[model samples]
Target: MRTFLSVIFLAAFSLFSFAQQPYAPAAALPAKNLAMFGRGLYPGNDTTYHLLKRSGFNTILLSSFYIHADGDLYSGDSHQPIIHQGKWVGDAGYVKRVKDLKTKSSISRIEILLEGRWYGQPPNTFDFIRDWYDPAKAVPGIVTGTGKESTLYNIIKVLKEVLGADAICIDDESVYHSPSIIAMGKIAADLNMHMTLCPFKRNNYWTEILEASDNNLVDALYLQCYDGGVRNEIKDWVQGLKPAQPIYPIFMVRGSFSTCDTHKGSKSVAEISKQLRGFKKDYPGMSGAAIWQMEDLNSFVKLGCAIKQPSSGTAKSVAEFLSQLKKALKKEL
Candidate 1:
């Protein structure tokens, strides 16, 4: 009889425990805040940083910090304000541009895109920045956690102290494993740097990522609503993650003049607003929308979000763009 009672008691306890778990969110949520991504440099656009400062996006996820083969992270060269040494330098003047932006406006945060090396780019071209996270190399210490002594941990420090990064965006397309994803979040949290994940799928990997991280360390997930994830429904994606986790549906700014990628799926400004609102209706806590390349955004996403920006095609300078955007936004407000 005691054994029978014990079984019943255990089963009851299990049921109670499951019932106590937090509820998954439902309902479309408002966009948390608008955001954008950009490479730190452009050929002739010296005022790129200044223009971005006035663009009114809450955060800017800079394109990227390369994870090395072993476990180290590349934080530019030894210089205090990292400047690329190589000639065809992709992220050249990263430190300086970020510094410039902070000086200009009060955008919420500036972050780094921790991405794997591109498939087409030759390994030699990336050696200067050590950009090589792949299925083979994997993310060395992200899951298990990295301590102060760890190179990856120090890289976080370098980002905070040197570049003044307010957060770190985990764009780990290489390894979607939960352990590493969780570890990366924990490490970034320990350093006082906010962690945001930009995931491509709505699957078990993300579910586990939130559950293992306890959905605490990660501030948001920049869901790629466009590009390969175009078919991804924001409502379902939001439900897949914990209710507390903010989601920002990021769209790709495509076309010939577009700087993000060659993938072209041009939606009108009205369509973008409708899709974003649909997500908000289903999940109210959504942070907002984000565009992949700020430079390529033109006026579609900006206008949809009510962020008045420069003319898509014009000979205007960055200063002129900022001036006009400010005036436009002031009138709208």
Candidate 2:
């Protein structure tokens, strides 16, 4: 068994080495797009956060919490249950981290994904909200079967007053929360915040969020391109909208086999660099790509499961690639 495992490792390494060769760029490269690198946060230290900033990532999608296996909602540090089954889970760490990033570095954006429901499977929309807002029971306007509560408003209030985040990415895993969506927009507007709701790829939802505000509530229409490599479809989706606001494609880094997914796709660090090179070569509509997580990126390397072994060679290759990509964008665009 040991010998077989060794052979498997050797074969994987050989494949990675061979895949590192340079490739000819396609005849035409699209206009360069700006991209971002980010990750999820858990309770504890901010080692990964510092690592990403050092690695040249300017934006982060910092998650507040999720419903754990124990069915208890856990928030990062600051301990505010950012979300319960389908209700508000408020925590102070969420605001603190954002403020720290702003004060500490030149971090450009912090996309606050309210009530994200990524479990063993993508959580149901209702499950995205906490159970306290359940409609079959009490809570009138507070929930309204939308699973929304005024408490979420308070959380946003704290974010604006305290952290001063640039944008809020509301993952409306649930689609029917018009009142909640509208109310959330109003709060954002009062604070002069840029708001976006990543609906389940529904155009109407984006339109509703856009129209609901006194001014344009929605500044961006984010598509959660989680499954399959769908870059080609993204252009059409962006242009297909009636009014056509800016469309930001937030690719999943750890969820799919596409270049966006961090695990299992590229074989080595050099290969990962090449993947970024290819993005510059294609996809014009792409504003930028965010690493779904720095946690996944580091974990894959730590466990020896990353496509390419994490060594100085791999890390340097990735850094050089990102540096060149950014430089290329500045030079060419």
Candidate 3:
């Protein structure tokens, strides 16, 4: 009888220890890569995917997934929804292209960005999550039936099962509910998917989430260093978050919002390269950086940024832009 009691105690203790393990940062990407975003990627064809495959980017981030009240998912301004009533209703060809982009090219990580609006956008993704999540019915590391019924769980599950996404980037700009995000993180972990934070500010909010998860749930911090986040400093974030994971600064390149000039947080290639050098100097531990989007890059290539037209066609011009950007990422400053 004593032996049986001893066995039970030991098993309980073992489980406790496993649950209390501290967060160890996940391994950094082997090489610096760009995160392609915007409407350009959604409608990409063989030619587009082909260019991206050889574009030298190892990671692609599909931006701004919004969740409706009925548990449907939409990317940006597209009329068609990606997920409707917990089922995938998006284009199959888009999925095929993504799969091919991952399997056939250098891309290894595909992350879907979940964004909330600043204002006026009713029923935002984060807002829905905050409103729907009930702590009383929540379980640690398990998605209950109630959870499955919720739009949050279904949306995340679809991202994992259907899209096979490696991670979900939390771009919760408007909503700042800690519990909702923490709950989502748990669901993400339960589904074998990692979560990353995209923060322009609110270090305390992010820090709380990291601490609550013991830093295990969130693997990286994609710091937005463009537009509203232009004033964000790497050193400040590093000091504030004390994150075990690497932080990648996202830069808004030229032609953002279809403008050629460097206004509104858009920077020229040379300007970006120089800014990167400065950031590297400030945070020597910086491991990676990301371009704001493919839309801006495409716009810049298609229509010159206050200069002469691109010397080559779209594909070639885009390739050259990527090559230059990659070099900027790799070259020693």
Task: For residues 28-66, write the lDDT of model 2, one tens digit per residue.
Answer: 111322334343455434665454455444555565444
The 10-residue segment with the lowest total lDDT in model 2: 24-33
Clashing pairs in 3: none
Please say which candidate is ahead in TM-score: 1 or 3: 3
Q: Once superposed on the true structure, which residue ranges of model 2 sit more than 4 Å away at CA?
A: 1-39, 44-46, 64-97, 116-149, 174-176, 214-216, 228-232, 242-244, 254-286, 305-313, 316-333
Measured on C-alpha atoms, candidate 1 has an lDDT of 0.55
Off by over 4 Å in 1: 1-31, 40-46, 70-93, 120-145, 214-216, 256-262, 266-268, 298-333
Q: lDDT of all predictions, in order shown?
A: 0.55, 0.48, 0.75
How many backbone clashes does every candidate have? 19, 14, 0
- Tens digits of lDDT, candidate 3, 1-333: 999999999999999998887544332244455555544677467777787788777788877677766657887746568887668888888888877877667777788888886244766888777867874555443233326565577788888778778778899888889988888887777776678899998889999889887455687789998888988888999989889888888888776777676656777767777888888898888878888888777788777643553322222377777777777776733
Return the TM-score for each candidate structure: 0.65, 0.60, 0.85
lDDT per residue (tens digit) for residues 278-311 in model 1: 7767876555677666554443333332223222
